[model samples]
Target: MQIALTKKLAEAVGVKAAFAQENENPLFSWTANWTKVWDNRRTEDMIVLVNNATRFTVAIYQVKKKDLKNLEVMMKKAISNTLLFMNINPEIVEEYMRLAGDVELVQNRGRQTAAWVSKAGLECSFYVGREYNGIEKMFCDTVGSLINYNHVNITKTRDEGFAPYQEMINALTELTGKPAYKYRAFELSATLNLDVYKAVRRIIVPANLSFERLHNVLQTVFNWKNYHLYDFAIHQGDKYDPAIRVVPNRECLEYDENAVLMEGHTLSEFLPEYKHILYTYDMGDNWEHEIELAQVIEDYDKESPFLVEAIGQTPPEDVGGVGGYVNFREIMLDPRNPEYKEMKEWARFWTPELSDWEKRPRVIRL
Candidate 1:
């Protein structure tokens, strides 16, 4: 019965059933992790159920509209406990919760109850039923209603419209106290080498895009799987300051140990003025690319990043680097070569689109 209920809950939330866990005790207990997807972010959700011969208790840990200060001190502790149980940092959990208000807890007393409306609109009311199937249906229906309510609310908020570009422009204008030039589009050319035969991609991305997002765009443009370490070297004047390099916070081997993270800094922060930069991917192969800011378009649409043009195929992964790639290409082009057939078979999965250069708009949304 517990397993069936667990399956039902997981299915209703569109999460894998494998995430649900059951514990055999005096009272059967079950817990599961779920996700709530919104326009800008995804939030973690948790559900716990305890049932015995006579009583049942259900708890939901999800984003709510009430602030932490508004919730009782006991409820704050409950929120902390829930975070600890989920192996999430309570501080981070609390911070996000504060932005959305906080996690809500609802409890009711009864053997049989019915659905009702709360101040927050439609809400699930727990009811303990004699038949296990009846309890399962009631729980599923109630939670389903809550999920639908939240989804509708979030969608409504998105539909109401928020102009991020306009907001950014306004903020900059206010800060500078002058009319600021808004760069809607950024034209960038990424080339593995300046030699005759080299892999190159010309992309146009929204100026507000973060460096991390730009990295993803480059990965897609080159048709290379992101399976290696990478960093952006930003030179100031004549010096290469390690502190200014953009690197992944996690697994970053920085010489200065104080390198800035690439997650939050946007392309607009260091482009146009700083036309040339170095992007290196894969520490072992040391595949380096020259990223040059070609032009900043004022009238271009500010939607998302996309590939404007591409040339030359991205070398097969683990093909040793530029020198090895040159050798492999030479052999593959000459079918008479001894290693031709073997190399051809190895390169069978190479993406042809990466080699073709064309003007394509809206290739990717982000």
Candidate 2:
């Protein structure tokens, strides 16, 4: 699609080129470690990308033939003026424009894979946020239209700080021709925490969870290193500590305009997509660290369940190494001690058990 568009643009401007290149321009400069894989895909011929520049991505199309300079000139102007490089109809343009945004491209190429000026370069395609593709584009356009028509400034924060999510869901429901009480954003927010936030952002919000609530939540939990709490809270399973309980806030649901009260109320439906975005966003530059933590937990549980169980069974130490003969509690609590190692080895020591007399005494560090 890109190649054909660039080729046509080249012809329109009466310029000929033998080959063309596609480049992707990223909205920002800081690259998240986990997203590196996806970012790398932008380098493919059909999709060239530039990262970390500003708020938008630029897709550049290189013409295959270099001789038609006139076509190149016309195409460059068309792109600069936000004209349709493709011969699609007004209806398609309106739909595409609503979903995506204006077309952006370089007016001219300085050199092969070299930087080009936008004014002189030929434009080939429309510019939208990196997330705006296909279905997402449709949803964004439809919802955005509703927001615009309703006179809701999505960019602004409401008096209650709840208006962002309310506005988004309200707009979405209106576009879908459903009532405002169809979805429950706040209910989903209260129960799901970060994982649900990540999932819902991908599916419903895609952008972020109403900036205000998401900001507060992230500020509190962002850099926390408590791996157990992070996992237990985000991933669904048996509660880590039975005594821990969450205090629910029903304020978001009380209002008619909020997303949580929408017609299709399915927490399950909203979780994964939101999570995908959150994980991708939060892990940004430090994504590797998070992955390592996740992998270690998974591997320990699988490759050596007995050891993991032993670690779990071990009780907390009272006073750091006070008694002689080494307390079982102390050994269990101490990760670096040799006693812990022996316990791990001994737990799996199925062939023969170590006799009490033969068991070595715990070594005391000076």
Identify the leading candidate in terms of TM-score.
1
TM-score of 2: 0.21
What overall lDDT, based on C-alpha atoms, would model 2 receive against the true structure?
0.25
Model 2, runs deviating above 4 Å: 1-45, 49-55, 58-107, 110-332, 335-366
Which residue segments of model 1 deviate by more than 4 Å? 1-183, 194-196, 236-243, 351-362
For candidate 2, the C-alpha RMSD (Å) to the true structure equals 21.4
Q: Note the Cα lDDT for every prediction shown.
A: 0.49, 0.25
Alpha-carbon error at 63 in model 1, in Å? 6.5
Worst lDDT run of 10 residues, candidate 2, spans 303-312
For all predicted structures, in order, the TM-scores are: 0.51, 0.21
Which digits, one per residue and each the tens of the lDDT, describe model 1 over residues 1-366? 222123323344343433222232212221222222222334323233322221122244343323212323323344344333222223444443354243222222222221111211122222111112221212121222112212222235666543322332343334345333323678888888724377788887777767877787787776668889888887543324422678866458446466777765987888766777678888888788878888988656333466767777777777888888778878877889999889889988654334223334445532
Looking at candidate 1, the ten consecutive residues that score lowest on lDDT are: 113-122
